[model samples]
Target: MADDKKVLDDGELVLVKDYVEEIITDLKYSTEDNFTLKVIYNYSDAYLRYGTVKKLKKAQEIFKKKGYRIKIWDAYRTVEAQRFMWEIYPDDDFVADPNIGFSNHNRGTAVDVTLVDEAGNELKMPTGFDDFEAVMNYDPEDEKNKERTENASMLNEIMTSCGFRRSTTEWWHFNDTDKYPVVEGFNSII
Candidate 1:
């Protein structure tokens, strides 16, 4: 571990499902469904900084009232996992370069999420998760992408309103405004 990095204990990180039961979690990195096409995580639970989880819980409450739910795709990635993803994608826009610095997800203060309907079906967005072509800030005036833009906009609005900063490149990625040091030694396993 670098001198600048901190090792967060389990107390500082909480399982997303434990914090917000209604929010669905599909940890894509735990399976071969992600861009890496390999399981990057040994466990499947999504974890985030406790403060970040609180914001997500608030977002989930708001979504519940609006007949939608949050589905988390990724959270709290280890530096090893980050390196593996970088090797596969090698795109700084999508995957953070561990050599330069760790990602917010490595700090447990960022998450990849999408909005799902009451039936747990994901809403139509500009593109699927980890799709590099997906732009977070799409042209709302473009009629061809009206529904996709609207859905992405709604998700962005709610997530940002709950104290998360939206990623300009990825529609599904959000970072907590409250900063936390890059964490080390934590894995997806319980």
Candidate 2:
């Protein structure tokens, strides 16, 4: 994690762009319109970095085993992008404060991903990414959203068992604990 004062203003390289490019091409998937790989950012928002190329590949492998694929929403966000999130939800604790330091994406340790069918449509989950509520927690019996909750729990379990941690608020978000240290302020090259 980057210190509050160590965030980069110009952004640094995180994942090698070729890594993302090669993976996308190899998978025969198309990038979403708003995100780098054409997935939606911030739950259908803009395109940016919230994941690294390598992470996406790993996610793809995991999803593939389950007969699905990973659909990335966002990856490698810039400081300005984080500022945009702050404007929309100032009280948000999920998004890192730009002033405090770089984000996980800046470090290339985090990812916002969803399970999708062969056609690339999203599956049911507790809530959409960045939903900002307990509704997204991996509870199996939250009546208000039971089906989604169970599914979210399943995803969380799978991801964590594979060394990824859920972001608490976003069912689709995950990160590799080991990769956290060197990722601060690392730039995205979508």
Candidate 3:
């Protein structure tokens, strides 16, 4: 890792809210609402690499000007959490297999996010967070899914323009192009 890079294990991870207050956070791992059906994180605040947070802040500013707001679902997952998630859903498509390697999220370089209207209602997207079935069923070309496709596309474009790469499988997931080492033995709680 670069000398200036921040990692969760080193206690240098940054809170997303501290840099981008305009971005709303609803960490699914911190609640039972996730596919895991369990609370995986003890902290409610979202944490990410400082550089990744800067990219997110840029995206949030663009969303704000477009009459939308950014809502983050997950960020900066610990290696232990990655292992737990893999045990529950071993599918490599959505959840990264800890045995092979950790996810970009485990390195604080990936984030799952969505767009919300001014009223805080989520915009119509192809699928909700962590819904692999919905992703498979979605057809971006179908007229029935036009609005959803458009919203998802817009989110992808803005995020990519701000230095994040969209996941080919998960619409809400984005990874920072800059690489970072996986954070091991880091407590998720603030």
Candidate 4:
């Protein structure tokens, strides 16, 4: 690490876009297309904790070998943004309670992501980002979801292989809490 001042200034978060090659980003909160139907973030950059970025880079290396790239939807949300999100969608199962504490995203240890092909097209999963419905809940035994399940499984394998764990509620979400401690508050990705 550099100096404490630098680390604190940067919020101990690295811009994953700067470290990873060909990483596609589509931060929904930065635009009006998200669940809130309003622009929340002032910018579109994505960020993760220093340790989380290392895991994400390793996962991306594995994905590239298999002809896929990572597509990030959200990462390192600010506390203000989290509060706005919770006010819009107060479901504990999906959105974390800002009053209680920051969620994985707010901690800068979680990422909402899916895989993309060599052509930069997103791979189909159970559902889109922030769906927050039963469809987002994945089950391996469901015959109807074989295709979706397989895609989700592949993503889980890639992420887990690099020290990340998939969220049971959202396939696109992953955390690196076991290997790296989650940092609460905000990383100033906005």
Clashing pairs in 3: none
Question: How many clashes does the backbone of model 2 have?
Answer: 18
Full candidate order by lDDT, most accurate first: 3, 1, 4, 2
Candidate 4 Cα errors over 4 Å, as ranges: 1-11, 134-140, 178-190
Best by lDDT: 3
Across residues 33-119, which tens digit of lDDT does each residue of candidate 3 receive?
Answer: 999899987888888988898889889999999999999999988787888999999999999998998899998889999999999
Number of the top TM-score candidate: 3
| Reference-based TM-score of each model | 0.89, 0.63, 0.92, 0.85
Q: Which one wins by TM-score: 1 or 4? A: 1
Error of 2 at 9 (Å): 23
TM-score between candidate 2 and the true structure: 0.63
**What local lDDT score does residue 152 receive in model 4, on the 0 to 100 scale?**
89
Candidate 4 C-alpha lDDT tens digits along 14-44: 7777667568888888999877898877768
Query: Regarding TM-score, does 1 or 2 come out ahead?
Result: 1
Q: Candidate 4, which ten residues in sequence have the lowest lDDT sum? A: 1-10
Cα lDDT tens digits, model 1, 25-56, are 89999999987789997878888987898799
Clashing pairs in 1: none
**RMSD of each candidate relative to the true structure:** 5.8, 8.8, 4.1, 4.0
In candidate 2, what are the lDDT values of residues 1-190, reduced to their tens digit? 2232544332334333333332221111123332223322322222222233434555567767777765555554555656655555565457676666766754545667767777766778766555556443445655867767666676777677666778755666676665533333422222
Once fitted onto the true fold, the runs of candidate 3 whose alpha carbons sit more than 4 angstroms away are 1-11, 188-190
